[model samples]
Target chain A: MKMTKIVRTTADVFYPFCLVFGLYVVIHGHLTPGGGFQGGAVMATGAALLIVAHAYEDITGRIRKTAMKILEAIGLLTFLFAGLSGILFHRPFMANWMAQTGKLFGNTVAHGPNPGDLNTAGLLPLLNVGVGIEVLGGLTVILLYMLSGIKEEKKP
Target chain B: MTPFLLLQALILLGLIVTGALIIAFKDLLAAAIAFAAFSLLLSIEFYILQAPDVAIAEAGIGAGLTTAIFLIAIRGTKRFEEKE
Candidate 1:
């Protein structure tokens, strides 16, 4: 295969791996180091790769810019809601509100027989997910807009 | 002599090199690519420094979104210029 073809094939394989790895980082954020922001950025890179390798028209057809914008906004609102709900409940902002004591996915997070279990922890995980989605969607929208703009410029 | 300190020193060196390269490079496109690398390295440094939240934000906003914007801007501008 030619160099360009090789690059395209590698990107095609790498995109799925990036997406899966990104999800793993986001989901296991509580126990591990990576979180939503990092994961989301990683995920967005997959989209970036696709944009770089494939035609703009093809990417646009699959990923609607308007929908991505809406999703991004919703993600931000979800994060805000999670934070404010803690304040409304007389807890600190972004406090851990979940049970936090039980076992989650076979991992003993917080100590048992107490309210501070890992499973029942506050809203950090949820917040992480929200932030991840927001970052991914927002970046996608920006990239798409820029690409479309470039296409339009080339046409005239 | 500790491994942790060694890692920190390496990350700091990366940041400095990236910053210098960004300033020294004449090509805006190259600088923009370096900027993304800078962001990623800085995020790693942040993680090592125990500031995961800031690191995450930097990785996403700085590395991901900012790079995309820069590339777009570069496409809109002249590709090359005489060195001054």
Candidate 2:
């Protein structure tokens, strides 16, 4: 049976906040406890919440499998690009080329614990974003597949 | 005992109860919900163990996503467990 209106409403309300928080975790991954995998899972959790609250046929319109595949591909490509960018810069295969460059996310860090800077951490933030998107797409795809495989029931 | 330890013990107890509930529920939906509860407790345990990253992942995947999948599957099949 379809979930009650209250459950659907609650899921709708919480979904945006979940997405935002997941993005925050991904963006601040370099300085925070969570990284790409964790943040992506969190984001996928939001999508799963919506799916659980609605019927399968209703959700297909909201979440397209093609779009999810594209998203997954993009994320993987971004990760590869980030890793290979080091070679493009004439550095090692996976060197920290952006570190200590005093550029975007390139500030150097001193020894020991100190006030963390978002502008530091070099390629880590970018890699985190890549992995985060990848994970979100992967997990959401699994949920969608499972949901779609089931026989659809009439809406209440 | 320290309050922190006491709280930890309570969480542990809750975990045991939820775990048992997951297996004992005749309704598959209820079992899935109990599994979600178990996942939540496991996440808390991970956090207490100083693995916040794992905790978040566990909460998201285990409690949230896994439960949703299970519910969807149950909706497709049957709510009650099939007796042999």
Candidate 3:
């Protein structure tokens, strides 16, 4: 059953905020209190908000299970490749070779009592993004699967 | 006690109340809402204790997603518990 118009509208209004805040947490994982899992859960909560606001048939079209599965695979691959990159750099697996390399997310960080820089986290932000996407896809897929199971049960 | 401590105590009281309410309510939907409230209060407690990471996780997964999932389950099954 679909929820009232007020719930649907409120979810629509808040969804973007959830996405943006989740991304912020993922991007600033090294500097902030939250990391990939929390951010991804927040994003998935946005998806859940939409899922609960609409009926099963109406929501499945918008948040396809296949797409979420593919997204989960992509996220895992991204994290795997990021970890494997350390081997290419002649370092141990998951090494901080990217740190202070003056490259992507590789800037020198100042000592204590200074403002934190986004580029100072080396491979952390990349890892955060990977895990964030994976968790988002995984959790949302679980919700979708549950909803689909309900649909099947509702039939004869 | 200081004001901060007093506020914390109040939140702790609320947690106990909501936790009990979850078990007391025969309406599954009401119980689910109480569970969400319990989670929200727990997250606040975590925040007060200087664990923002856990706080965010609790707020997102426990309070938000769990409530949504529970509501979905209740919709699929039954809203009120059957007297055994």
Candidate 4:
């Protein structure tokens, strides 16, 4: 069954703002108070809003399980690749190899209580992105599975 | 009492009320919505406690996602708790 008009409108109006905020939290993990897990869950909330507003059948086509699986795989693989890259470069696994290296995300942070710099986190941002994608995919996949399973339970 | 502390106390009270409502309501949908409200209050409490990361996570997973999941489950099963 479809939701009331107000619910649909609320979902539409809130989704874009939630998406942007989630991405901001993910990207600014090192510079801000939120990290990959938190931001990813935030983004997942937007997906949930839409799912709740629409019937399972109307949404299953768009929020495909296969696509979420692929996204989850890519996110985890990217995180592992990052960690192993440290080993390949003769550093310990998951080491901050790029910190203060004058490269991407390599700016030196001040010693104490300074405002955060987005460009100074050194591989953390990448890791955050990876985790964010993974969490979002994982949560959505779970939701899709539940919705799909319950579809059959509906009384004829 | 300081204004901030007063505000915090009110929020805490709201949280308690909502938490009770979650259990007290026989309608599963109302309970789910109450749970969402409880989560939202908890998120605010986290924020007040200087844990914005936790606050955002709670707001998202607890308030938003969990409520939706509960509603979906309710749709699958039944909206009202059956009298035993």
Candidate 5:
């Protein structure tokens, strides 16, 4: 228990730094080896650290079960919506619609200074973000159920 | 060896060790902690494998959330005792 406290404190102190680094991983994922999912998970570690340090009561009050459930549902729906949008636009499912927009940092990234650059990859970044959100939300719900004290009844 | 590969190997080793401990340990609380470690290590392995999405899912749901649940469950149940 004493050891757990020490570990928890260290992790809590380390969380902010981890969050920043996780964002970097997500934003630069297209250029590097990481993406939204990886970064989001890393971000989740920050929450993990807090839970360990402060205990579940402290954390649960901040992140209500109702909100988490809503986020999970929304995330899944958003992902499906994106796919449907592609179909509605007369394109195949999961078509790169952002390619038509042809903008980066508010302007066209392709055919600009960094032509055919990794940053210019159409719709991939957005897709990555969506996937990340969905994964995070879904995982959170699963974890919540596991953490909640609802037990299975035994039969005589 | 690349840093990514090195991390990957370390995470995998941690995962295996924790998994073994979780199975071998009779104490439910210790086993829960070991399982949490297993989840954390698995997340790191996922990151090293260039699957950040999966890594995040594992870290949040597997390590962070699951550990909390285990702690609560432990509170609700009887602690493990040695067999006579």
Candidate 6:
């Protein structure tokens, strides 16, 4: 069963906010309190909001299960590659080799506390993005699977 | 007692109350909602304890995703508990 129009409308309005906020959390994970898992769960919460507001058939068209599966795979690959990159650089696995090297996400910072820089944490932000998307895809796919189970139960 | 301590106490009391409510409710939906409230209070407690990371995780997973999952499960099953 679908929710009321008001509920759907509210979910639509808040969906982008959730997505953006979750992205912010993921991107700023190194400098902020939340990290990949938390941010991804927040984004998944948005997906859940949308899924709960609409019917299964209606939602499947917008958020295909195959797409979610692909997303999950991509995220895992990204994370694995990011970790494996340290081996290529002759460092330990998942090393922060890029830090203080004056490259992308490698800027140096002062010792004391102050406004944080986005380019300060090397490898961490990349790992965060990887994990964030992985959790999002995984959680959303679980919900979709549950919903599909409900649909199947009603059939026969 | 300090105001911070008072606030913490109040939140802890709320946590216990909500925890009990989750068990006491006959309607599974109501129990799920109470669980959400319990999660929220626990997140707040985490924040006040100087662990914002745990707080954020708790709020997102415990308060948000878990509640949605529970609601979906209830939708698939019965809303009210069956008598033994």
The candidate that wins on DockQ is: 6
Ranking by DockQ: 6, 2, 3, 4, 1, 5
Q: What is candidate 6's lDDT per residue for A1-156, written digit by digit as tens?
A: 789999999999989999999999999999999999999999998999899888778999999899999999999999999999999989999888888888999899878898899998889999999999999999999999988877888898
Alpha carbon lDDT at A136, candidate 6? 96
Single-chain TM-score of chain A, each candidate:
0.80, 0.93, 0.96, 0.95, 0.72, 0.97
DockQ of 1: 0.55
Candidate DockQ scores, in order: 0.55, 0.73, 0.70, 0.67, 0.32, 0.79
Chain B only, TM-score of each candidate: 0.91, 0.89, 0.92, 0.93, 0.82, 0.95
Q: How well does model 4 score by local distance difference test?
A: 0.87
In model 2, which runs have C-alpha deviations exceeding 4 angstroms? Answer: A1-9, A89-92, A152-156
Residue A68 local lDDT, model 6: 91
- Model 4 docking tier (incorrect/acceptable/medium/high): medium
Off by over 4 Å in 1: A1-3, A87-95, A99-120, B1-14, B40-44, B47-65, B81-84
- In terms of lDDT, the best-performing candidate is 6
lDDT of each: 0.79, 0.87, 0.89, 0.87, 0.68, 0.92
- In model 4 chain A, where is the ten-residue run with the lowest total lDDT? A147-156
Native contact fraction per model: 0.61, 0.90, 0.71, 0.74, 0.48, 0.77
Task: Report the lDDT of model 6 for residue B7.
Answer: 97
- Arrange candidates, best TM-score first: 6, 3, 4, 2, 1, 5
Q: Evaluated against the true chain A, what TM-score does chain A of model 5 have?
A: 0.72
TM-score of predicted structure 3: 0.90
Per-residue lDDT of model 4, residues A53-156, tens digit only = 77667777787889999999998988998888899789999988988787899998768898788888788999999999999899999888888768777656
Task: Write model 2 residue lDDT over B1-84, tens digit each, in one string.
Answer: 998798789899999999899989999989998998899999998899889888988987897778877887887889998886
Tens digits of lDDT, candidate 1, A84-156:
8888778887765553434433324545443332343357678888988897888888889877787778876
TM-score of each: 0.76, 0.86, 0.90, 0.88, 0.63, 0.94
Better-scoring candidate (DockQ), 4 or 5? 4
Model 3, span A8-55: residue lDDT tens: 899899889889999998888888889999999988988888888887
Q: In candidate 3, how many Å is residue A47 off?
A: 1.8
User: Which of the two candidates, 4 or 6, achieves a greater TM-score against the reference?
Assistant: 6
